[model samples]
Target chain A: METKIKEIIKQVKKGDQSAFEDVVTFYQNKVYQICFRVIGNAHEAEDLAQETFIRAYVNIHSFDDKRKFSTWLYRIATNISIDRIRKKKPDYFLDAEVKGTDGLDMYSQLPAEQLLPEEEVESLELQSYIQQEIMQLPTKYRSVIALRFVDELSLAEISEILSIPVGTVKTRIHRGREALRKRLRRV
Target chain B: MSCNKQFINLMHKYLDGELTRTDENLLRSHLHSCQSCQKHFHELKRTTTLLKSSSELQPSSNFTEKVMASLPKEKKRVGYMRWFKAHPVITAAAIFFIFMFSSVFSAWDQDSQLSVSKDKNLIIQEDTVIVPEGVTVDGDLVVKNGNLKIDGSVNGNVVIINGEHLMASAGEISGEIEQVNQVFEWMWYHIKDITKNLFAFTNK
Candidate 1:
């Protein structure tokens, strides 16, 4: 699969533009998860992830083919998602890029229930707790933590994805972990 | 008892699995003795666990389709002949330098012979250039039409075009290694090389 992606990358670099769709499809889930984990939203993350691939497509020339392709893609995804967070209002997730109301919206189709089960409510609370805490983190720490936790990537890989020093990556993960500890202990 | 603030970073590193054996022992001793530190480490550990366990959001089924539809048209990569025809002066200079560098500096060997640009502290066995174990190569190494087996270390970028590169178990590379296994990759490699040279010249 890695070699195949490399070949596709070569083709894309050679101006076989249709080949980029394969790249997009191959990476969409991962790219979306990275954005979703960071931004804490489904719809905006999809937009940002789409924007990530599009940016990657347009700026593919800047990417060196030697390094891991996912590193470059993750870098683009991280930067785009963080930029959206920085530019918009602090709580953009509440009113963010929730695009068209496709009739197939999953939540709308679910049967209405008077209440979620107690365990479901507890898990939902924890989910919101986790989301709120993640959103509260500074962007630098947010991106690093998301990359670290979502993918369980090594600190070195995080360094490559963020283009920061490994030492810096370590420091951020340490600080980010400590920050989360301080916040979540309250819960 | 009271916890020293210094062991705070150690607690996080312990969770991250980055502690060296010695540091691990030290932190373990500290944790064994420190009550607050233990509680703090537990909280930190749980935070990461919960973060990992957080709900994952799935993209709409049409996500890839939407992204694919919205991409801007590719500028379209031009073939070398088209590029050369478009930039005649550059093409001429590039051709001149190609011959100049080939003949004067690192010439491509005819008859499918091996050509490696740097041989500083290199051991050659047939067509393979081996950076011996414990030896460090200080600069970029480009091998053409041959194989490179790095068992030691390279402090610079390694480019293998029309060749194979292998990393022995003990090998380490500080910079990236680019192995071009395809003809298209080879073309783009040269294009990038020529463009870099041209850009450097134009900047000057």
Candidate 2:
């Protein structure tokens, strides 16, 4: 898959429009998923996803081949998501820690175990519940959680995509998990 | 390390199987006796599991098509403006050279040829040359540093240097006619004459 994507990117660099369409097809879902998870809206996510590809197309020449193409695409998608979120909610702070109902930092909350069985029906409900709580996390924590868990990206990969240190990525993931655990415990 | 702090710090790494053998043993021993730490570990594990299990949202059916449609057209070739933008120094240099060449060429003196008239009616005064009526100059007529008054026919080219040529209603010039009256025009003419004479002497 990596080799295929690299070829597609090379073709795109050579001004092959059809190869660009292939790229858009390959990354559309993943990019849309990232945007949707970060922005938490279907319409806005679609718009941002489209905008991300548009930006990628326009600036495709700046892409470095030494790095993973997915990482580059994720960077564009995540930055666009962050920008759109910031634009929509001017009062939201990325650096500030989100607090739960107990007046403690959400990330500092204790982790909890799954109290229900592994029934498929209950699992779906739990999944939905977890996603809602994930959405409620602070923007920074939500982004890391989405990239870490939803996208199943490695900490180093997340670091590269977000342009942060690996230690910071691990810390954000830990905090994001704790926040979700605390929120789920209430339910 | 203290058991509680150690457990708290290593809980994530432990679930992720990133702990070393010694730390893993220590955490396991600690979890056996510590219910709070064990519960926290289970919860964190469950949280990550649920997060991983969440389904990725699929975009609309036409999502890729829409994205492709929205993409701006690829700039396949370097346009003149884009080349100019990229090579600003070269563009500026070219423009400067063109301007300089045009200015120099425009300022260069234009040469005027002279021929004396053999006609009897041609009158040459101190500062004015006049061709009276019913007279025809058979050769090229050139008036230098003076005005020319023509009332008859001239069979050759008529040129005036540092002066004006006034032609009456009945006057006729059979060849090309020109006037050079500017100060720079005179300088240009003298420079051109000197260069020609020098070239001719060099050839000789």
Worst 10 residues of 2 chain B by lDDT: B110-119
State what share of the real interface contacts each candidate retains. Answer: 0.80, 0.84
Q: Is the docking of candidate 2 incorrect, acceptable, medium or high quality?
A: medium
For residue B161, model 1's alpha carbon misses the true position, in angstroms, by 56
Please give, for residues B136-158, the per-residue lDDT of candidate 1 as tens digits.
88888888788899988988999
How displaced is residue A10 in candidate 1, in Å? 1.0
Candidate 2 ranges with C-alpha deviation above 4 Å: A90-128, B1-3, B75-204
Could you tell me which residue pairs clash in candidate 2? Answer: A112-B43, A113-B43
Q: lDDT per residue, candidate 1, A46-65, as tens digits?
A: 88999999899888878787
> What TM-score does chain B alone reach in each candidate, compared with the true chain B?
0.45, 0.40
Span of ten consecutive residues with least summed lDDT in model 2 chain A: A101-110
